[model samples]
Target: MPIKTTKKVTNKKVVKEETKPAVEAKKEEVKTAEVKKATKPAVEIKKEEVKPAETKKAPAKKATTKKAAKPAVEAKKEEVKPAEVKKAPAKKATTKKAAKPAVEAKKEEVKPAEKKKATAKKTTKKATTKTTTTKKVTTKKMTKEEQYAKLSLDTCLDLAKAMSMNVTRDSIIQQLILNPDVKSVSKDLVNKYQLTGKFNFEEDGYDEGLVEVLVSKVYETADIKPQKAEDLQADVDHALNYKFTDVVADGEEYKAQFDTMRKVLMIAQHKDIHDSKNLDEEIGIDVEKFVEEFMDLAYSVLKTWKYEDVDYYEHFIYAVLSQLEDLHDTYRNRIMMDVADLYILHGDYGLGDADYGYILRENQIKDYIYYRYASIYEGVDKDKAKQIANQALQFVDDRFTYYPNIIAVLEG
Candidate 1:
């Protein structure tokens, strides 16, 4: 009974705590309820609340809730309804606050997964790019090798032919055949080895293996007999001594002399006059020396026939003069006078013009050389010839014969 009394006291205290605002709300609702008993919905809600409260507030000793306790219970229930309405918005606010974190947590969870997926995509892209680069590098190397392999034998032959234009036709083929990988030889292969020279093919017939055999032959016959200065000098002497008995023979002889002179000129043009050969006994006589020696010999031998064989004299003088240099004054004067005489005979006035320095420095037989040159120029430029003749007159001595005819031509 005591415990039951204590529980009722606690319940009453709970009701009393809500009573202040509830009583105010109930007074407001009662005024409104009387005015709108049939029309207002809040009046019906208040009556429903009152009925439940009356049943709950029955005395503790009664088997059933006592009817005498009804009015107070109804008033208490109306006051409690206002408290429950106030608490309803608070419960909804608590539930909304709890639900907000769950939504945020879902977004946070999805963000990491999306980031991982983006990262995976980037990694795959990088991997694909690397694969493509590696494939391109491999393919490029393969293509270059294949390009070299695909080069045709015809192209090789063409390269050999083109290079042969400068060297020999068979020389290129010979080099290709000598190579261990002859079948693989191409234009670039020949270029890599840098093979060149004249071709001397001795065989009569043509065969596919002919080029290869020639190439092999070059290596076997690579020995060259070093030419001595004496041998070259002998050849020149033979060429200069060539003589003619008649007009037909004279043309042929002159042509031979000119051709021989041309060869000597070609040899003189080489930078290494002696080449690689060591011909120690032959001193001070290279291609140039050989040429000078030949000229002196020709002049001594040919001077007797100069007036009768005008064509031969002209040819011989022009050949010697073509390779002659005006280095030693005595030697130069002899060559110049000989060339000047040839010019007079040939009517080539331009060839007779000598350098003034070369003329002034001539010491041996100076008067004779000056007079002779002056005589040649008299037909072209008489005033200039007279001046030269006057200069020659100063050098005349008892040792020399000053020709009166030279003076007469120069004066005219």
Candidate 2:
């Protein structure tokens, strides 16, 4: 009985807590009741907290609580009514406090419900988004290899043809290369090996294995350069700058030619003061030595090279002619020009024209030669001088129309 009364008093603290003296009185009453129960009834005792003063306001709160306690029913009712909706912090706080009794056991119990709520909320959000929004799912475009394959087949065929490859066979190979696994098998197959020079294939009647035979020839003609066209382009650049790679024999010989020619021009210009002003004072002595070294290196560099390529031969010949002219070796250059002319007449037309043009434009062979011959024959052989001048005119172009004036200078 005392235990029940103490519990009831503790519970009753809600309302009576407003009046401090009343709460103290209630506590004293609970103590007396416990004493009475202990003393009078060792047998049995029952106590009712039926005091109207104590129970009246408490029941109203209890009635309110019973309505609030059935949260499911109350939520349903609120849903139906829709008018009693209100924010209630005190309700939330009380609910949180009441939940503390079994918080440990209930925490686990509440987990699945919270998870279900979360899942449902997520589902609803996704469904709403699906209805209200439009989105595009994009994938990456083709990678480089894929793009290369995706190019038009016609474009591939044209590219192969321009590169002097057999179109059908190369196209098959290129198409096979669409598969990376297969592409690895042919990494070294379609290499860029150049087949230079002119050769008659009409009598050969389209040799089926010409490409292979030509590649073999390149190895023989140009040394087995295995680094693809990368090295070939570099070779061209070096040649343009009058240079050769160290791989060539006597690779510095062209430097010597230039060095001799450079000194000839310098010495010819400053001959009156050569005793005092040195070549070093004019262009530093080291420049002449450096060019000499280059020529020494280039001496036999062209030995292995055949004059088979028309353009390469022409450029080589022109460089020699220019160097010779720089050294005032016009007579020696005439012999070189005759050598080039003989080679061109053998079949190469391009080199022929280049040699002819060099002589005609420089007025070396036409003006100087005719003048030299005419001066030697002047008065002593007037008929011979006129005949030589007329012969010179036949070879000269209108660009060198001053040949007659050159002849008149010789005559004077």
Number of the top candidate by lDDT? 1
Candidate 1 has an lDDT of: 0.44
At residue 396, candidate 1 shows an lDDT of 63
Residue-pair clashes per candidate, as listed? 1, 18
- Model 2 residue 366 lDDT score: 69
Question: lDDT by residue for model 1 over 297-340, one digit each (tens)?
Answer: 44444433444354444444443343343323235566666655
Model 2, residue 289: what's the lDDT?
40
Top candidate on TM-score is 1
TM, every model: 0.30, 0.26
Off by over 4 Å in 1: 1-237, 244-251, 261-330, 340-351, 354-357, 361-365, 378-387, 397-412
